[model samples]
Target: MSRYPLRSTLFFLCPLFSGLLACFIWAATLPPAAAQERGGGQTPSLGFAPRPKESAPDKELRFLRDSTAAAAISADELLEDRERKRVIGRGFADLRFLGKRVQADHIEVQTETRDAVATGNIIFQAGNDRIVGSRIDFNLDSERLVIYDAKGYLGATYYITGNVVRRISVDRYEVIDGTFTTCEGDKPDWAFHSRKSTFQIEGYAHLQAPLLSLRGVPAAALPYAIFPIKSKRETGFLIPTIGYANRNGLEFSPRFFWAINKWSDATFGVDYYEKRGSRYLGEYRYILSKDTAGQFNTTYFKDKLEKTTLWDIKSSHISSLPGGWGFSAVTDFASRKNDDRSLERNLNDRVRQDTDTRLELTPNLKGIPGSLRVAMRRREGLRENDGDLFQKFPHITLDVSQSQIGSSEFRYSLGSSATSFYRVQNKKTTVLQRFDAAPSVSLPVQTVPWLGVTANFGLRYTYWTDQKRTPDVPGNPSRDDQKQSPLSREIWFSSLGVAGPRFSRVYNGGFGPFRDFKHILSFQTTYSYAPAMDSRDRKLIIPIDNVDAFNDQNTVSYGIVNRVLTKLKTGEGFETRQLFTASLTQSADIAEARREQNLSANPRRPFGDVVLDIQSRPISLIRFTHEAIYDPYEHEIDEQTTGLLLEGGRNWYLGLDRTWRRKRSRGRDPQSGRSDLNFSAGYGLTRRWFLEYLTRINNVQNITLQQS
Candidate 1:
């Protein structure tokens, strides 16, 4: 193992540090290499046995392992001299000792010194390393070998030829006038020419006075360089990306990957914006066990033109805790309001409007027949500098599974949570503590095939501390409000939900591939009322979240959902799929009798807009979806979205979507002009190759918003 087991990285570094290769040489220091089983350490005795005279004249001789040494030798002829304790072999001479082998046309050895000399096409082999030269001088005692005019390869990749290759010691080597390359064939794609190079087996390779050539053309100059060798991932410079963009000019990004260990790794790089500035990026990943893993990625950039610095970060973690507990976390954060627009590198991530950071834990509460959860959540707008943001911390919740009420026709479930709410808008910040609990029960009053009725009722109690009556705004509090006397509120709420008269029909499909098709329809309604609080009482409650100011919702929401399911027979079995789905919903606010619209300041009629949604999948490959909101007063669609999709399970895909709006705009909100069409398509040329195209066009602007 080379000091850097990922030696492939050196192939690129050698060419990059060509001129400086001669200035650096690392002396790798590691534990000594393992030696073959031997009778004695370091210097082992040597023994030689010659072929018997009675054997055929052309038959070669073989040596037997004896007490003197565990070495084997074979040759066409062998001669021994007791006076000098020397042995000589001629013709096809081979020697194997201490896990190393040597082959030569002729060989001579001094058994006393444990030194050997070989000439005429000498070949040496040790471990995975092999070398061929005309002559060699080796010391079995020191296990040091030097080959003259050597040419061979290292680690199955570095093909090296040198004037003199010498193994100074076990796991250490030096080569003079060496030229090496990773490319194969008679002519390599590129090669490094160096005056001298040294190797620390399974560690690093150092070269001096090295020059790189690409396709026989000199590419770079380096006096010296040190390269770490590791498998696959390594600590080294990676291939750089270069391109030209009108906004960024000539861009170049260089990256480096560090394989910290088997379970962890990291990558650091710098992206050149040319016109803007340089951006530094880093990512780290680690796995502690099969169920534990985490990763973090971050970026920092300072724009010269904009004269602003920006930062972005992303992280995710999942782990299994002791005692049947699980934990996970996710974060996407930006230091600046528009950091996503200024610094986000991912196309999809930049289009998102907000960043959500959350951490959650699920624990097994002993003897509890319900799930327990603890979590903290934060939502930040990517483009909002001073809008209200939600920050909930230490939100603890428990959900008890529905259980029978003494074997009665009624069952009940309990759900409750306690949370600390923190909200910030502009320069003001609001903080409050909230505790809520709700327990609900349902009775199956009717269970006929055509008419089914289920009635549900629940009571919810909530308490808020450190609260201040906020103005009638979208969760925005002024800075001075924090100084006002804090107040607390204890509120009670109730809700009722009913479902009945669900209709269904099954149609035998003698028509397409569908074996059977069924259509089902259901109607559901819920009425919720919270004691209407006076304006002053409501003001005592800070609107820190969507649910905070809503202690006065005397409203009812009713909706009908219908589905068409189709069953298809696969070769293995049968599968059911919802082929079509549709829903229409609307709600009336009776307490207020009028509610403001999202984009308009004026309160509208009590009757809310009717929202209709439909989805149809006639076949496995084709799908269609549509949604529309009808304004009762305007008698027109206030907003609409529709899309179609065609899927090719393995090779192709197409999707087209359009969004339209009639409402006016609010500050910093998404534009609501003419419909915008988004189209995307992809086709696979081969199993491993594909091409895709995507574009978004704005009809109002009459320009392409985005295309790729």
Candidate 2:
């Protein structure tokens, strides 16, 4: 045996094919533990097809019966009573009726009533189902039976045993001193034993005085329990949870689910903490139609320790409407301010201090796809004293998709937006309204299989109804600048990108079961030029967001992409996969070089930081990735991330990840730097033994922020 790895590569375009094929259905007798589709379907377990009238599980499970045949019976010794319409058999008697069979040592049957009584070594068989008992009473026509000391096997994977068991109806059974197991071996790995129990074949079960056992040995006992018998979603109470936390003391919660209907469901639960009172949690999900589905989750509680109320609500919705329209929305809101941590919530959510709610609608404008979006956001802990920073009360955008220009290679796209930026502090308010539009046209051409070239030209126009002096600038603005109204600005931009000249080589070592290996090297280049804005015009711009901090870019970027591909041997054939990939890119600023040349400065400004990305999956069970950004001027790796994942065997899995960012100067914000290490691993010592561990270490920024 040898290790083989599976791989995936991202491709911009690929060919797809679809064809219609003639097909037929076939019946198979699956293994004892095989799964099936129950509820009104054929069992197919007893090496036979199903009868027509047995359409619902609520009806009898019957095999195919001969239409023009008579009842058959045989025994070593037999007796008949014509007057009473009775028959008696002794010494291993056997009877066969319509889709039913029975065998016993002594048997008596009534012809008119279709009833039978068997006492010695009785065995009854139905559609893919069999039962053994000492004494049995059955109705042939109704397919109902009762037995004493019954041990039964039903469906594909279930077993039942009881002192007294009755098949009240189809899929419903009553038992006393019964046991149920789905395990496959002669001795079940686990089972549920109960004194009084009722089982529904495709639904759930209710057990009284239930005892759980592992490998036939009792492990735990519960006063009452309910278990879902099928794999599909079912309306029932979920398993209750219990645990202890340092601040919450003891915690307990039990959840109930309502199937509502085929397309919707809801789950509700109440969490009780010994020292922190109670919390209510709920979630609702629905699918109104093929194109519509949504979910909402919420949690609320009144804290006893803080004597305050807390809540968190979230929702996500996506639906397509008539008239070539599609809609989606998401919302997140919280009440009060705290860590938002409880026994029921993850501690990592404590870092959240801001939320964004957005609504969007996509339209097919004369068969062209476009989208309109409205969003609002709120932020906290942005100021030194930890007050309010800024809010986008309602930002709007409409963007049109890029499309071909009427049988030509040229393509065009349009984007427009409106936004209101507001800041609140000390009962004073600062507000600004900004509007902008940007449209671009692009041409893409591929002259050869290995070369692609694209050129783009765009114009951006912005208008502002409000303006405010930025405090960070060197000098105060004149009165005339402050009084300026309805300011607007415009700019034209262009860019070019070339991706081509892929170099590749194939090595034919013909290693064991492998055909060969292929390696590819490709280059990508992009250049953009934006004219610098004069100081007079720059002063008119409002100081908000990245758009306000725009800088002239006369820069060119170069990137090299490397990829390795290999074929793996499978039972049937060989399959190709990507074994490794790495990309490196760096940029040179021509504008900075020209500025330094006029100043006649020595040792001109160096190129921008270098970025490196690498991914390797040498074997099926191991993966590694590394990413880093290095500053050439500072001669240091300013940011880096490395991760490794492994699965040694069935029970030996592990992962490690490290991320760090460096702040080069002391004046930089302390919170801008981070060094975090995360590790998680779990292993099974044996079938009955296991070990697991996980941890995270944050080595920077000791600030404590609050949220609710």
State TM-scores per candidate. 0.59, 0.66
- For model 1 the TM-score comes to 0.59
lDDT by residue (75-162, candidate 1, tens digit) is: 6677777899888877777777666788887889887776899998777877667778889998654568889999775554456789
Query: What 10-residue stretch in candidate 1 is worst by lDDT?
Result: 30-39
lDDT of 2 at 50: 25
Total residue pair clashes for candidate 1: 35
Candidate 1: deviation at residue 628, Å? 0.7
Clashes of each: 35, 1
Q: What is the lDDT for 367 in model 2? A: 57
Taken over the whole model, the C-alpha lDDT of each candidate is: 0.71, 0.68
lDDT of 1 at 706: 64
